[model samples]
Target: MFAVLELGGPNLYDYYVNQEIYSSENKYEIVANIARAAAIALNELHQRAVIHLDIKAENFVIALQENQIDLKVDPFSFKLIDFNTSVLGTDHVKANTASITKIIKAPEIRKKSKNYVNQKVDVWAFGIMIYGLLYSKLNEFNELNVNVMSDKSRYSRLDSELNYYRSNPSNTNLDIIINVFTIKKF
Candidate 1:
C-alpha cells in the first residue's frame, strides 16, 4: 500500500534564504520554533528506533496555515521530511557520505571511517543546524580555527565562542544555542 504524505510548505532552507519576507524581530523566533519542532520530531523518530542518516535544513518542511504561517499558534508546524536515507534500529548504520550535507556531517562521517554511525551523529547534525539558524552562517565555527578531525578541538573552540557571547550579552539568541550545547553536555 502506498501512503500519501502532506507536501507541507517550503523547506527550512528556502525559508532561511528568503527570510527577508519575515520581520527581523520574528525571524529568530521562527527559526527557534522550527529548531524545537524539528528536535522533537527527531527525538520521536529516534525513540521509535529510526535513524535519519540525512538530517539538514532541507529535510524540514514548514507547514502553512490558511495560506499563512504562525508559529506562535502552532509551534509544531514544522515537519521533518526526506527520510529516504533513514534506517531502522538504534545500532550504528552505514550511510552514503556523499548524500549527506557537508556542513552538518559529523567528524566520523567526514573522516569516512569504516565504523558505522549511531544517533550521536544525528545529535551533532542537529547542533550544526541550530548553529546555522542562530548565526546565519555555517562556517562561523570553522572560522574559529577549529580542527574538524578532533572533537576536543571543536568543543574547545565552541567553548571560547560561547564565552565570548556570554561576556558580550548583546545577542540573546546565542544563549539558546549555548543552552542547547550545555544541556547536551557538548
Candidate 2:
C-alpha cells in the first residue's frame, strides 16, 4: 500500500520555514488553515481509535494536486504521515516515550508511566501544536521550564496579556487551556 501511494510535496515544518513554498498566502491565513486541517485530521484519527503518538509539524505532509499550479488553488491539502510509532488501538503502554520529540510530547509520554494512557494525550499535543503555530515558540510552554511553571511568572504574563480585553473572565479560559497542556500524567 505504501508503495502505491503518491509522493507528498513537503512536510509542514519545512513548508512553513521555507518562504518559497508558503510565500503566496497571508501568514495568519496559512496558520489558521493548517490548524483547521490538523484538528480535523486528528479528530478523524481519534474517531477511528488510532493514536498518532508522534504528532509534530514534521510528520504532517502538504499534499498538492496533480497538474495544479502553486497558489492557483488552495495552498495545499494537509496530510498526516509517518505512522511508524503510532498505535492502532487506544491502549496505553508501560514503556518510556522518550523516542518522540521532547517539545510536543504529551504529559503521559513524558512521565514514562506504567499505567494506561488514552486519547487525551493526543488532545494535549494538539493544543501545544496550535500554540506553537500561533506564536512559533515552543520553549515558553515546555513543562521543564521553571520560569513558565512558576506561579509568579505565569500569573504575571497572563495578567498583562489578558489586560487587553475588557472582560476579566476571558482570563479563565486562558488559564484552563494552559493548565490542560501543562498537566502531567501521574
Candidate 3:
C-alpha cells in the first residue's frame, strides 16, 4: 500500500539515531526552517483557532538542496511530515498523549485543554526547532544580521550583506521565509 514512492535517505532522525553517515553542518538551520514554515502554517491554523497535537522529527522530511556545500554540514532540504496525532475542535484530545514528545508538547495540555492550548503552542515548537539548528550559536540572537552571524568562518560569506534585515531580527526578515534557496540567495 505504501508504494509509488521515490526513495531517498532515511528520515534524518534515523540517521542520527543509528549513527549512519549524514551532513556535518549543524542542521539547526534546517530544523529552524521547518519550524519557521510550520509556524507560518500554524499561524494560519491558529487564526482559525486550531491546534496541532503532534510535532516531531519523524513527521518531517528534508525537502531539497540548492547550494553546493564546501563543508560537510551544508544545508539540505526538508519538510514536516506526519499529521496523525493532530487535535482539532474540542478539548478531549489531551488524554491521547503519553509522552511522545514531552520536549515539544504544548504546556496547555497540562494546563487544562479546554482553552489553554492555542497557536502559540506551535510557536513554542517552532522555537525549539530553531534552537536545534542553532545549538552552538544561540547567542547570535543578539546580533543584528543572521547572515553576518555566518559560520563560514571557514569559507564563503552568507550571501551579500545586501539584504541587511534578514540577519537582524529587529528588522525581521521573518516575512522573507527560509527555504532550500535561502543559503544560495544573493
Candidate 4:
C-alpha cells in the first residue's frame, strides 16, 4: 500500500516574501517560531540518521485548513518537501552537487571537503534560513562568492556576512538576533 501526502499552503518563501506577512514588530517572533519548528524537524531527521541536504525556505510549506481565518493566530504547521536530495545516513560519501542548492549548502560542501559532512550542515543551512527570514535577503547572503574564499578568508567572510545582516533595518530586534544565533544543538 502507498500513501499520498498533500500540501495545501504556499511555500515558506512565498509566505514570507511574496505575502509580506512579517512586520518589523512581529517579524522576530514569527521567524523565530518558524526556525524553531525547522530545528525540531531537522533534529528528528538527524535522530533517524537522515540528512536533508536541501533545507531552504522554498522547500518548506505552511499547512492551513480551509477557510482558516486569523492566520496569525491559526495553528499551522511547517511541512518540509523536496526530499530528492535526502540521504539515508551521514555515512554516505560524495556530496551530490546536482541536488544541492548553491546558496544553503554548508561550508564543507562549499569547500568540497571529502570528510564526512554530518548533520551540522543542516544546522548551518538552517542558520542561513533564519537570517534570510529576518532580512528577506537570502539572495544577497547566499551568493557563491563567499564559497570561493581561502580558509582564513572564508571564515573572515562569514563574520562580515553576518555583520551585514546585523546592520539591516529588518533586524531591529537585537534580542531575536542574539537568541537565534545563541541556540545550540544539544
Candidate 5:
C-alpha cells in the first residue's frame, strides 16, 4: 500500500550545500538540533522494532514554513523520510548491502556477513551522518585518506578518527552530539 505525503523543503544535503542558507550565526546549534532530530527519529523507529536500512542526509528534509524554507533549527522541524528499505524486526537480518551506501555502511554490512544486520546498523549510519553534518561534506569511502586503501582499512581508520573526536570534545553542541553518537549503542 502507498500513502501520500506532503512535499517537504529541501533535504539536509541540499540545504547544507547552499552556503547562503547555511550561513547562520548559530550554525553549530542548528546542526546539533538536526542531529538530535535524526537521532530521536531513529530512536523512535528502533523502539517500534523498525530499522531504517538507509539513513543519510538526503533522507531528511527541512520542514517548510508557509511555503518558505525554515532555517530556525527546531528539533522537530526536520523529518526523516525514505523508508522503502526499512525492516520491521529486531533481529539480525540478511545483509542487503546494495541499498546501503558504502560511506555509511556498518562494518558488518561492509563485510557482507549473513544475518549481520541489526538496529546497530542504524546507529552506525547515524554516527556517520553526524560526522558528515559536522564536517559539512559527506566524504566518499575512498576520500577518507590520500592513499588508497581497502574498504575495511578505511573504515578502521574512520572509526579511530571518530573515537578520537569523541574523546576530545570541544564543548560545542555539535561535539556533544558527536560524542553521543559515537558512544551510543543501539
Candidate 6:
C-alpha cells in the first residue's frame, strides 16, 4: 500500500545556506539526526548483506516541526533502489563502476569494483555525508580534507577516496591526494 508522507522543507543538500546565514544549534541537531538515521539504516542493511551505494543529504527529508527531520524511505525501503551499482555479495563479486552515481562513490567501490564491492562501500558514503555536515567548520578547526570535495565533481574527494581505500587498502592511502587524478578506479 502507498502511504503518503510530507515534510516542512527541502533537504539541506537541496537548499543552499549562504555563508552570511548563521547556522543554529538546531541545524546541527538536524544534520546530526540525518546522519544518525543514515548510519543506523546503513548498519541494518549491512546486517542483511545489503549496501547503500548512495548516501547523501539529498536522500533525507526534514519533518515539519519546530526542529524536525523525517527521512524518506521510499524507492529504497520497500524495494532496493540503485541496484544498477549495488553488489549482492552472494558470490564475492565486485560491482561495475557503471552502476552508481560516480560522485558519491566510495573508493572501495572504485578499487575492488572490477565486478563488485561490499558493505564497506556504504561506510565510505557515510563518511562523505559527515564531511559535508562538518565542512563549514573547517575554517575554524583548521581542518582540511585530503582530496577536498571535487571542484569539478560534487562529492567530497577525500570521502570518496577514503571509502575506496577502506574497501581496498594499499600503500597509497596517504598519497590519494595526488593519486585520485592519476587513477581510473577512484
Best-fitting candidate, scored by lDDT: 5
In candidate 6, stretches whose alpha carbon ends up further than 4 angstroms from where it belongs are: 1-12, 15-22, 61-84, 111-113, 136-186
Q: Residue 150: error of model 3 in Å?
A: 39
Candidate 3 accuracy as lDDT = 0.44
Q: TM-scores of all models?
A: 0.67, 0.63, 0.43, 0.70, 0.73, 0.50
lDDT of 2 by residue, 1-186 (tens): 356868777777766666542344455556666776777678788888887776777777777788654633264467788776666667664334546555555544555533355677777777666655555544344443345354445545544543544254455445544543353679
What's the distance in Å from true for residue 51, model 5? 0.6
Candidates 2 and 3: which is better by TM-score? 2
Which pairs of residues clash in candidate 1, taking residues 3 or more apart in a chain or in different chains? none
Q: Which regions of candidate 3 fall more than 4 Å away from where they truly are?
A: 1-50, 64-77, 89-95, 111-116, 136-186
How do these models rank on TM-score, best leading? 5, 4, 1, 2, 6, 3
TM-score of 5: 0.73
Cα RMSD, each candidate: 6.6, 8.9, 12.7, 5.4, 5.1, 12.0
What is the per-residue lDDT of model 5 for residues 1-186, given as tens digits with 9 covering 90 to 100?
999979788787777777442567766766776777777777878899888888888888777777665455454466778887787787776655665666677777776634457898888888788777775546353266345667778778788877887787667744566554575558
lDDT of 1 by residue, 81-112 (tens): 88876767787776666556545667677656
Model 3, span 155-174: residue lDDT tens: 12212321343356432224
Q: Point out the worst 10-residue segment of candidate 6 by lDDT.
A: 73-82
Clashes of each: 0, 0, 14, 0, 0, 9
What is the lDDT of every predicted structure here? Answer: 0.67, 0.60, 0.44, 0.68, 0.71, 0.48
Among these predictions, the greatest TM-score belongs to 5
Deviation of model 1 at 73, angstroms: 6.8
In model 6, what is the error at residue 33, expressed in angstroms?
2.1
State which candidate, 2 or 5, has the greater lDDT. Answer: 5
Model 5 CA deviation exceeding 4 Å by range? 1-5, 19-24, 65-76, 139-150, 173-175, 178-186
